[model samples]
Target: MTRTDIASRTIAAPVARVWAALVDPVALTVWLPPEGMSGRFDRYDASPGGSYRLVLTYADASAAPGKTTADSDVVEARFVDVVPGDRVVQAVDFVSDDPAQAGTMTMTWQVTAVEPGTRVVFRADDVPPGISAADHADGMNSSLAQLAAYLEA
Candidate 1:
């Protein structure tokens, strides 16, 4: 059975701005990671079929363990679809020895214009069994809040 999680938030920003946050590598690095974590993009190509590598490091070294090596989680991802100002779909795989976390998971981000702002929806499909749904939802919500803050600044 495939596990899925979805989270949505209304940001006080335009759709274009939200889309920029999704596609721009620098913007993504600034707002993508959850609280207490930092992200760095090794490579980023926004077009369909383009791939990227990102490393996420925890603020506390002790927090790493089974999730990743030492203090960082490395993710290799490819863009499956990109619809400007609308949606983005990507496939992601974590670099880990644990078999439960070894498969490709698809994530989709949808942006819609709403009154006075934009609504952003984050959906993850075929999530690894090793990941907790509550934690994933919280992280996604945190990321969304960070995105809103980034755009507001």
Candidate 2:
């Protein structure tokens, strides 16, 4: 099996609160986008087998062209599973003309109740070749940091 990209953070909040941020579309939109970007979901459903289309826009696209357009990248994803406070699994694909970026990436987020808070572990399986490892890692870490702040605030 190909090794997955992993990022984790221990948030200063309970499992239930942290879980809420993961499944709530409103909360997700606030925190899911990495630094230097913002996002909006065209449609979102958190239930098992539900699907969503999210468009993430860079603050300054001239620096980094998006996969779907000059300024925005679309993410088409389906919820593979939602285990409430435990885990949320999704199959994700980028809407991009670039063949190197075309593939279903399995994103698994697992949560564990820790001493001071909830430990959120994010794993990205089958990451598309077009995305560099460093870039993906930074994105994951950025999102995790945002998640922590969103919950602790």
Candidate 3:
């Protein structure tokens, strides 16, 4: 059975700033990659029915090989819904030959105004079995932390 992973963090920024970062492709490349990984975007179109391609490279691929290549994990994602300053929902698929990692995962990033900050909630549904629960949680948390830092700094 497929799984779902959810992570949340409060960012020390207004919802507008956080939302801008969430929708901007360049901002994503800066803070979306988890710890120990860096990412690049081949193409990006942020809107309903639009899509983007992201390639994430590991710092040390020898330790944790990638699904798309020896050192990279490529992703093709479509924006299902984009609500400014509110939420973004996407359908994400990994570019990999391995069946275990094959499938469209629904990703939702939701934001709500909080005292002196914004609460960002990230949810991944229908996660492929190839991704471990522990790793997914860590990655999501890492991304959230990075987002906070990018906006706060």
Candidate 4:
């Protein structure tokens, strides 16, 4: 099966700034999640052959005892190509206790310096089955909006 998904957003910032926000651990964690959520990059090596992980935590307004409304992750990612201020490609595999999600995915990001600012195109390949493409699209759009807000801040 061939799984391909692409999403794009234009930010009011230069290509270099957008690129930095994407690869920089501090900047990424600051804008990764939605406004209320918090995130952190456990280990990030923004170079080819280097691996990293990101952990995102969401708050649950209503959680009873013994119930959890948060999710944490350690996605193993390695930079495959890094073109400073232009593009980046990374291979990421979800690390979970469940055997079902053990698969590799490639995420490619291309930044074009447009008139207003920068246009970023994100393409994710080899998405696992059972995951809805629509959901991913929506999430990417939401994330892009949040990223724009972060960059403007």
Candidate 5:
């Protein structure tokens, strides 16, 4: 069976600002990684059919092995759809030799204008078996919090 995970947050920012944080490489570098990790993008293009690569490193060397390797996770992603201020969809795959981690995952980020701000919803479909749903949700929530802090600053 395919696994899916969803996370949502309401941020005190306009849809345009939230969308910018979602697509901008610099902003992503600041907020995309979860707690205890940092992210660097090798390439990022926020257009349909555009591809990007990113590496996430754990602050603690003793952290568990990532989907791709020990202490780090590498992702190759292609933009499947991009709608400014509304949504972005991407197909993602991890650079892993482990069969459990070798599959295409679809991630959708949907933004909607709320009374006081914007609501961002994240949906991850076809999650690999190697990823625990609770952990993924925690990471997603952490990233959203980071985005909110960055935008509200």
Candidate 6:
């Protein structure tokens, strides 16, 4: 089997709460980023064949119209499996015009209850050739940290 891009985090909240943050669109926007990032859900039906779009926003004084800032990128995804509060499998796609620049990767989030907290494991497969795996790893870690902080708040 091919190795996947994986990241895991332990959240100091119950499995149900952490799971809510992962699957609930309203809750997801609360902690999608460490910086000025937020997501909006369009058709967030969490089930096989269900599609959703997450719009990420950032403040960019220097950016031109229809351009993303250095701090934000919007990722639209469709769920492959909706495992309630335990696991969620989805295919994440970065919205872009170029086919070579555009591709889809599968993201799986697993939540396990571990005493006064929940362990969330995230795995992304089929990373495009041009993307940096390490960069994604760093970003994912930061995002999870942000999620944990939001949960605590």
Q: Put the candidates in TM-score order, highest first.
A: 3, 2, 5, 1, 4, 6
lDDT of 2 by residue, 1-153 (tens): 344899999999999999999999999999999998999999999899999999999999998889999999999999999998899999999999999899999999999999999999999999999988999999999999999989888
Candidate 4 has a TM-score of 0.85
Local accuracy of candidate 3 as per-residue lDDT tens digits, 11-110 = 9899999999999988999999998999999999998999999999999999889999999999999999999999999999999999999999999999
Sort the predicted structures by lDDT, highest score first.
3, 2, 5, 1, 4, 6
Clashing pairs in 3: none
* lDDT of every model, 2 decimals: 0.91, 0.94, 0.96, 0.75, 0.92, 0.73
Output the better candidate (2/3) by lDDT: 3
Please name the candidate that would achieve the greatest lDDT relative to the true structure.
3
Candidate 5 clashing pairs, residues 3+ apart or interchain: none
Q: Is candidate 2 or candidate 4 better by TM-score?
A: 2
Among all windows of 10 consecutive residues in model 3, the one with the lowest summed lDDT is 1-10
Clash number by candidate, in order: 0, 0, 0, 0, 0, 0
Off by over 4 Å in 4: 34-37, 61-70
Least accurate 10 contiguous residues by lDDT in model 2: 1-10
Best-fitting candidate, scored by TM-score: 3
Per-residue error at 7 for model 3, in Å? 0.1
lDDT of 5 by residue, 49-145 (tens): 9999999998885866676668889999999999998999999999999888889999999999997999999999999998888889999999999
What value does the lDDT take at residue 22 in candidate 2?
A: 94
lDDT winner between 2 and 4, please give it. Answer: 2
Please report the TM-score between candidate 2 and the true structure: 0.97
Between prediction 1 and prediction 2, the one with superior lDDT is 2
Q: Which of candidates 1 and 4 is the stronger one according to lDDT?
A: 1
Clashing pairs in 6: none
